[model samples]
Target: DQQVKQNSPSLSVQEGRISILNCDYTNSMFDYFLWYKKYPAEGPTFLISISSIKDKNEDGRFTVFLNKSAKHLSLHIVPSQPGDSAVYFCAASDLSTSGTYKYIFGTGTRLKVLA
Candidate 1:
């Protein structure tokens, strides 16, 4: 069972505005992270992520920040555009449990970029 959950079901932002998506987890053992974005009629695509050792990771217009103490994480999209509208999901891996990684996925947050 996954202890991860998306804090918001949806978000609306004006074009060129910043969009932030949030997620929370009950387990503190998660070490690896993965962020995925999904569009209509397609599988989720990898976005960005940050490991437990790191507080933040960024790539292009995407950035992920992890707060281990609060067991929370967030994704930031800069200059949000119409093309950036999609469902974003967060997944985490816990390797300390069995030496192998087990992935836990959270619900998705739909982001709508309004023109």
Candidate 2:
């Protein structure tokens, strides 16, 4: 079974610092990983993603890293700000026999970036 897990329920970081969020999975069949941020009563917004073939991917202030051997991944935010405070979710997708894909998401980790 594919299971995505976020070990930390929350994290606090000072403004202008860095925030690191971790995630782990149990399925080798999974090939893609993504991170999302959500605000209260709103839909999640895509933050970043890394494919199984890539070890790391970066986009502006966000970075996503994947460790296929350990079935683990992480998201990093530099210069964390108060506006970055939100729920972060790690998600993995796998291609099925039907030629479609299924996504499994981890329990979100709430980040509070203090000023």
Candidate no. 2 TM-score: 0.94
User: Candidate 1 regions off by >4 Å?
Assistant: 96-100
lDDT scores for all predictions?
0.89, 0.91
lDDT tens digits, residues 1-115, model 1?
5599997989999999999999999887788888999999999998987889999999998989999999999999998999999999999888667466767788899999999
Candidate 1 weakest ten by summed lDDT: 95-104
- Give the per-residue lDDT of model 2 (tens digit) for 21-43: 99999988889888999999999
RMSD values for the candidates in order, in angstroms, are 1.4, 1.5
lDDT of 1: 0.89
